[model samples]
Target: MSESKNIEVSGSVMDGMAEKGGVLESPTKKPPTEYTVYPIRWLVLFIFVLYSASNSMQWIQYSIIQDAVVKYYGVSSITVYWTSMIYMITYIPLIFPASWLLDKTGLRVTTIIGSFGTCAGAWLKVFSVPQDMFWLGFAGQTVVAISQVFILNVPPRLAAVWFGADQVSSACSIGVFGNQLGVALGFLLPPMLVRAQGTVDEIAADFRLMFYLVAGFTSVLFVFILLFFKAAPPSSPSAAADLGSSLDSNFLQSIKKLLTNRNYILLLISYGLNVGVFYALSTLLNQVVLTYYPGANEDAGRIGLVIVVAGMAGSVLCGLVLDKTHRFKETTLAVYVASVVGMLIFTFTLDCGVIGVVYLSSIILGFFMTGYLPVGFEFASEVTYPEPEGTTSGILNAVVQVFGIVLTLTYERMLESVGDRWSNVGLCILLAVGAAITAAIQPDLRRQAAQHKG
Candidate 1:
């Protein structure tokens, strides 16, 4: 009777019984528990970094070959400047919608959208170059700039999602470093590839080649991301992994909370000013160098190279230190103070015609200036924990874009009126104000550490 009843029991029911019993039993064997671990978060990070670099490469492409572009397209310097300025200008309005997209959807969807937009923009420029179609190129840049709203907002958020707390700052730094590297490459490559001395026809040819090369690279990266990029790992990487979702479901409430946070507001202002100065300087580097050293287009590129390289090194080093020390406030303050001093030196020495001093001061300034970005991003993350990192970072970047536009225009006009020397003097005053604001920020590292530990 027992054997007959056992045979009558369904295999499906038995399997359910086994599952509830915490072990599956069989006549001959018992199966072992299985667990899966995915550790390709770093690989995911690298993909986004490449995407970031590609997007940024487009930002300064026109500015790098400023004279050649101006000559080839038969445009005013201001019109040529708008090619890059349009990027900063467009970011002002689109960032809010972009933040909503990132928070509501996960990283994979948002990043893919950004990646496709970038590839489209790059290819559009490739077509635009052959005809010397200024409007077409501007339209392409506008599209690429729109993509930047997505790409630039991801570093801190990506670091949080993909890396453990110990490596969060370092990962964010690497991500931000990608953008800086792109800018460096953008500044260095064009001048070398499209010679200032070349004829209009020759310059136009080189420009077309440059766009083709960039578009090709961007397309490859886009394909890689489409295939391999995952939204996140299977398991949570850190205690704060879910913090973004833990925020109030009400979007307006979340924004209100973030605005009311004192530390965040202070850091926002300071970071904006610092990044604003950088935007002004980068956009006007060629003009400033040419004003002092005429026909030194190659030398201007070299100067950009040194400044960005030093800045990259400084960014990584600062990230490593923050990882170890978690000294967000002190590290930020020190960098700000150092930036002010370096900027002062660079400003006063610009017209002295001493190439060595200009190089030295600019490198020093870049080291501290660019280094502040990662620190600011990470610091804001710490201060605004439990609030979405994307919201905080996105808003911060939006504010920075506003500053960039304002300062870039101000410096451009000042360049016309007073000169590069006085324009920098105005910048140094802004830096001093930034350093003071940074000094006032008081982050709750203990709470942040506890949250990460949890």
Candidate 2:
């Protein structure tokens, strides 16, 4: 763990740091107590919510397209897996480069570029390009990945910069809540939006309509960004000056420092395992139900629907808890533990006759499963010192994306070969290990932060 560079400074104190004196030397000086809130700061927060909503809309489109994608583009059941897998694969590699851009270019430019890329991808999907369809689809996925990098990494840093510490956790929670809400909508709305026709292609036409909807909304966001996003305030210095250039340490050296840090390494591994379990269970749940019972596709889909709503509620509640408690590490560990319990219920109890018990268990699992999104980022943002918060958060995201990449590439095959039940059980065990690793690293991180503060 490293020392965070973000410090608490009032306007007068900041002015004193920027200039030589706390007092403004003007033609006619006002009272020292005279202060006004920066309206743009509020704009930043409002736009954050909108940005979140737009980003969430993108999620909605994917969930909408998933079944349609399978019916039309899907050649095999494995093809169905690619919708999540390839998207993650293409998206995972972008995080490192995207984070670098965030560090170098600042938020406004990178975010707008992300929004532009996302809209482009969405538009590509909106039209039917039959020849070389897979590659075109891959391109769309690539752009979406870039869009996600900006969405996930930029807004939190924005909140951290513009708001006080007391407000940051709340902002982070609200931002994540918006994302989950978007995801829930994405999952919930698509079935209705992609109106069924007699043929798969006909349904896919409706899916394209949904893609247009997402693209149009994101395009509006891009326009808003062009009008409002700022790399720096009119008065603020360059980010290079604010946070010194990373050029002094070569890439390998910087990476070595990051990897060698005990907490960072553990955090990466923990999150990776979490991603693996989350994806494995998420993708395999339907299959698991079908595997256990041939006629259970509808049941599994219903269960997944419940999970999404429960997960959204969990995210909101967890955010509120994080805001009040600030127990980032402990909360994360507890979530993983709960995830393990949920996995057990899924593994063992699905066959039992207790319908209410299974539903409650599934919802509980969903709740614990996504608890990491906000807390994990906050922990990485706060604990990684010497490096900019973006750097830490970026790499953390990269790690998760890498797991996502792994999930895309190998999980289906693993599930097919090992059988869903054992694979899920193994994933649950692995997630428990992730929780333990996170727990193991917590004391070291706290000790380091305390030492730095002292």
Candidate 3:
């Protein structure tokens, strides 16, 4: 391949050096040696993941204290729900802009912007705690939701920029795992901190404290990202790192190209369906539990906690397997099938009146459903090689957000009309469709080999 063609295909054209024949020297000139920049890359990744966790923790905060929030603000359930729902809704319009920003700027600038937005939103919520200021809380959530557009698009990009080829999938998984861990913390913490049985005044006090804690944590993360996160290493860590070239070149063309790729589109839809269902489930778990098992709000939180924890574990395991075996297609398909089974088990066990069975089913459901995320994310990046990671990931997330909003609204209506048991049945059908679609995704392993060889 001509040097420019190679740069176009691999997305790694170095600046100015391409004019010297090629940015990467021919193998005969000097064998590529992987650069090991100890501690710095890992430290940057840690800060990014922490920021992701904080964003998620803020997103799910109101949901965890759902009843208390509604009572405290004297608002309807729909109003309280909008705090979380707005996050997905905002992504619909903002994700493309977020992607463009990530591609035009670099990881540091994009992430710092996002971190600051999250910090500002968190503190805004703290101010919203006094009097009839529900609107302030909504305003804060809207800002945080906008920040999510930037934060969610960068994990795969960060992993590609910082980690070696062999570790890329694993690293991506860790980045994703941090978001899920924050979600798990979101589920576990709020219920414990803001007691359901407390008087309205007492509940409001606890809710205020929760907001303060999240705001403080997010401020600390913002400071850390500002101080430490680097855009990319001084030298490329792997051939995949060369793909960073695409981040700066042909942003519009890359979007057009991604839309036209067959595998990328299929993976986009399949991944969206699976993740949309996961988002719906996460957002509505408290309602789902309370619907069938009336007055079991705490149990709902417990179930959510188990699902998120199990899902995080599943994400790490899937990432490790992908790193070792490069079995993206197979792993994704298997996880989809597992999710279907778990969904079936959970749906059937919902009203069995046995708490143990319900918990077990939820754990199983979470492990597989949540587990499919990293595999799907990495697979999308692999199939759409040479595209900016932010662009590909941004499109993926945008699609998932669209699906999430539609499904969450649809399922909420179904929960009222069809009841929780049948509402879950609908989710199962969606999971099965997602699995069938996943089966059609043929990963371009040749592209994988070429990326590694570069």
Candidate 4:
């Protein structure tokens, strides 16, 4: 039976009991009791983290394919841009809706549906395309993106509920670090696999290979979900205590509460712009490498691997710093500042010996680029109330994605009109703005948290 139908029937029975003069002791029909479940919740979060990690390969693999795609597909630079863009556009907007679905249906069903969609999308990429492969890849990515709506937004809320507030940021940071590691490995491995084949077709083979690999990997997580994942039983004390209070909160009120907080709004804008610049730069990095280092003549797979490896280190370092310090704003602002400086180096110092320039820029960019995830989500979590954390997070995720839409359009036009150099300069400016905004809101967010705690 459907979850909604089950809920309705349960409600009717409860009402009938009350009408017959029976005591309505519990909001849920079941008894209030604790469990011997120990710490299964952390295990569940880890599984979900792996699920998110597997999907990261789908997007991050683009960097590896950058040259192969340009060579085989004979397309413009914008082609790789949209491969990442398709997924971003497809997935980011769905965050709010995914959160709403989680509230209504629970994680099991939502995750299953997303997992299936992602798997199917991956399989479709096996065949060659008639038009721009962007649309075909996009169809698969759309599924992954839509699936991600559930995967990305729900986790931190789950972390908050299962692990409690003090551990929330740390748990989240670890999970996100897993996601980046997947991205790193995705970039690192594909080129080597292609090289072993001893032909360009062998390299081309990796695209189809990634689809099957990521799909099969992520599908395994679904089995774990089916076996171990469940709604908190009605008999659980937490469920019983929350039964009435859950009904009392409205969607509109939750939105109003989140928006009215000035600090939260500022953080959202900063994150959105930050993501916009990040995506734009990531998509363009391969082209930048080719332009500056003419002899490097490396495939997209190799270049992408280097960047992803650097990014992996950056993500872990960022998580460790935030977990230890609990200073969300300081961490984010510092990363943004570093990224701005890195973008400048990539643009202005292009003629300096390629190795010194590229290596320094990549290391700095990787270190600063991905660090935003840890602190950005941490900031969002602190601003939101515990109950509505999912919804609030969904909104923030969607807003950042909207900025991605702008970045997509602007990156393409700038790439064509002025050149890669100017396109990057614009990105540097956005990073600077993001840092400024994040820093500005730091004092306000600290004050609000103090007020809420007091």
Candidate 2: residue 421 lDDT (0-100): 62
Q: What lDDT is obtained when candidate 1 is compared to the true structure?
A: 0.83
Candidate 1 on 343-440: residue-level lDDT in tens?
99998988897888889988999999998889999998888777777888999999999899999999999999998878899999999999998888
What is the C-alpha lDDT profile of model 3 across 1-454, one tens digit per residue? 1212222112231322355476554646654443443346678778888999999877777876688777677788767667778989999889988898988788989898999999899889888876588899889989999999988878898888877776789989999988898888888888788877788778778878888999999898888888788888665666656645534568889989999989889888888888888888888888777766777777788888999899999999999999888988899899999999999999999888877888999889989999888888899888888788889999999999899989988987888898888888998999899889889888686436755466
Error of 3 at 229 (Å): 1.3
lDDT of 2 by residue, 1-454 (tens): 1112323333432343337544445747553331122446666666666766565455434333444455566445555555555545655677777777777677787778777877787787666435237556656755675577776666556655554434556666666666666555555565556643337656656666666778788788779888886654333222222233323433345556777787778888887777566655555555566565555444554566577667767766776786566677787788777877877877677766655566777787777776567767666655554455566776776777678657645656777798656666777787788878988875344312422222
Shift of residue 296 alpha carbon in model 4, Å: 4.1
lDDT scores in order = 0.83, 0.61, 0.82, 0.63
* Model 2 TM-score (2 dp): 0.78
Clashing residue pairs found in predicted model 4: 64-301
What's model 4's lDDT at 207?
Answer: 60
Runs off by more than 4 Å, candidate 1: 1-38, 130-132, 242-249
Tell me how candidate 4 scores on lDDT. Answer: 0.63
TM-scores for all candidates? 0.90, 0.78, 0.91, 0.78
RMSD of 4: 9.2
